[model samples]
Target: MYDLTGFQRDLLYVIAGMDDPHGLALKEKLDQYYESEIHHGRLYPNLDTLVEKGLVEKGTKDQRTNIYRITNRGQREIEARRGWENQYLDESATPT
Candidate 1:
């Protein structure tokens, strides 16, 4: 997880937060958050990286779409990341 870039980390969190999201769906969520376009050349390769790392599983939903889901290892990594974050953040901080 620490070896991943911020964009990769964001991808992991998005996959974990949503139901099995296909590539375009993932792109849409990222666009909504970034308020800008994300190129396929950039997106697909990074997703492939996550796949190679065993943190995410990629499966086909249809001929035209690929769905992504976080692995158990991915979930554990997320929990670990949250725990690490909580250590530095004040517990009483207001939401947003």
Candidate 2:
């Protein structure tokens, strides 16, 4: 998880938050958050990286679309990250 780039970490969080998440759907969420476009070249390869890292699992939704889901390891990593963050942050201090 620490090895992940910020973009990849954001991608992981988005993937965990969505239900039956696919490439375009994930892109839409990120695009809205970024207030800009998220290109396929950037999106797919990072998703592939998460897949390669065993944090995310990819499956076929259709011929053209791919679905992504977080693995148990991925969920654990998120929990661990949150715990690490909590050590430094109090309820009054919102994380930016």
Candidate 3:
């Protein structure tokens, strides 16, 4: 897997958590997590990057909205990240 920016990884996790997640919904979810407004300038381009990387698929939700979904490759990448995190957690949990 390639090294992804924190924002890109967050986008992937958000998309993976939802079905047919639209841009607005993603913005809202991120805003809630970040406790600040997420501007469209930052959101759409990162989404496009995920699309270019084959980690996300974009489809028309309506005339003005685009929906996003995580691909199989994205899922595998997330799982790998989770596994890596678990290894660190396990190591931390071990008594010295």
Candidate that scores best on lDDT = 2
- lDDT string, candidate 1, 1-92, tens digits: 99999999999999999999998888999989989998898789999999999999999988988999999999999999999899768565
Off by over 4 Å in 2: 91-96
Q: For residue 45, what is the lDDT in candidate 3? A: 96
Candidate 2 collision pairs: none
In the predicted model 1, the residue pairs found to clash are: none
* Cα-based TM-score, every candidate: 0.91, 0.92, 0.94
lDDT of 3 by residue, 56-91 (tens): 999997899889999999999999999989999999
TM-score of 3: 0.94
Model 2 per-residue lDDT tens digits across residues 1-96: 999999999999999999879999999999999999999999999999999999999999889889999999999999999998897777549666
Task: Compute the lDDT of residue 9 as modeled in candidate 1.
Answer: 95
Question: What range of 10 consecutive residues in model 2 has the weakest lDDT sum?
Answer: 87-96
Candidate 1, TM-score vs. the true structure? Answer: 0.91
Candidate RMSDs in order: 3.1, 3.1, 1.0
